[model samples]
Target: MKQHPLLLLVTLTCIPAWSLQADAVNGGIALIPLPDSSIAPEVWYHGQRVLVTGHDGHWQAAVGIPLSQSAGDDYLNITGSSNKIPFTISHRDYPEQHIFLNNTHQVNPSPDELSRIHGELKQELDDFAVFDGTVDPHALNLTKLPVKSNQVLSAFGLKRFFNGEPRAPHSGLDLKAAEGEPVTAPASGRVLMTRQLFFNGNTIMLDEGQGLISMYCHLSQISVHEGQLIQAGDLLGYVGHTGRATGPHLHWSVSLNGVRVDPRLLLTPALNASLLPH
Candidate 1:
């Protein structure tokens, strides 16, 4: 019998024996438990496909909570499931950061520059919306470091002011690296897109399969092209002070199901601990 996707989801989600286990905080990852191990179910949240993985006779969907998401009740719908899995997102207070840019144009562009900026923004959105399912789902290990730098200059979710004017929050992690330092892929994946933007400079976006994507920006050089298959530690580019940056550094971002989350969340515990203050 060909069961409807939603019907199958309902059956799997209704397994009362298993419960969803995941942190419910801004920039957190949600692990939605599934009832059946035999069937790989499709999970969706806000119209984007969620990443699913199996363990110990059960399956779970890994959903990234965007820092911009408002606090309070939220839900993810399993395609074949009759009911939505309820989740809560708690509030998080990120520190504020102010930066003075020598290039005032980056903060406020001219009319001609504004048009170019808008075009780049549209292209970025299109790249992020891609969900590649053919790549091996198990290949994603977000904890791997793309560059050998423990010096974190800018943390994620930081509210920023540019030259006394409020700007968008910092969406990625900035690592202190010298210009011409090589940046590698943190995970095995295929290059989905690459762009040189008004703000990001040279950038490479890797599709890690199942809605997991990683981006490297502000590079002095880009070695990989779009549609290239790359493994972990493969050279994608070199760090630089390109685009709107203040100095030479690598800005790395990770997205799950189209939601940008803290790149620190993907770092291994040991690495994370070492980076913390004493």
Candidate 2:
């Protein structure tokens, strides 16, 4: 087919952008260059931090990743820029492990009850995804954990299966803690969502502004509420196996620009330094 001159030019122009759609940066890692004020959030690899910088007329942000977050296909859909760009993320795979939830707790419901429980859990998670909040990402400084309890029981990005049926990849870190354990905010953020979920039990969602959000699940009780602005080390709630848990623990997750990334990546020195009081 004979292509028109304009069509050929347009096709050539899109080649580079199209190629980028399949590119993957590590989790928490992004090379954001906002030449214009219109670029939206981008997705980096699933387990690495990405660095982004604004140059010339562009603004950028980079993210470095830690050993959390499951690897898989991810995308960055940007908007409101002079140019709209969507980046593709290719996640590298890490080793996988499984723990037998084989021993059922006496509190476990019967099979019919479990089915009902699953439905309720889905509803709660959906609520977090559709939460309404002001899109802000810079009003607060990301901070370090106030205490030193950083042991990880379940790392992010591991593919999960329930009862031999493949399930969604795990999106958060599961830290072992005793019931009634204190949970604190790692940084300053606004409480955007707080609810009792079927699977999460007591839950909290914090908005760190600019489309960054954090989720804390399976709490025994929630201490914050929607629209409440909280500071670093602020009390969020107590740990428990509230939702669809096999035991008592805390499931912590982080989402950047709406993409679920490994929360541990944000704890690194580079990201942490950027969050300190200047």
Cα lDDT of model 1 by residue, 1-278, tens digit: 89998786656544432232246678777776766745777888888988876655477777888778889998888877888888778888889999999899999999999999999988877777778776644333345577887788898888999999998888888988889999998888899887788999989999988888888999999998988999888999899988999999889988888888776666655656666421
What's model 2's overall lDDT?
Answer: 0.58
lDDT against the true structure, each candidate: 0.80, 0.58
Candidate that would win on lDDT: 1
Q: Give the backbone clash total of model 1.
A: 9
RMSD of each: 5.4, 11.1
lDDT of 1 at 41: 77
Find the 10 residues in a row with the least total lDDT in model 1: 13-22
Off by over 4 Å in 2: 1-23, 26-28, 36-58, 61-88, 102-143, 146-148, 270-278
- Candidate 2: tens digits of C-alpha lDDT, residues 58-79: 4454433333434554333333
**Candidate 2, which ten residues in sequence have the lowest lDDT sum?**
14-23
Estimate candidate 1's RMSD in Å. Answer: 5.4
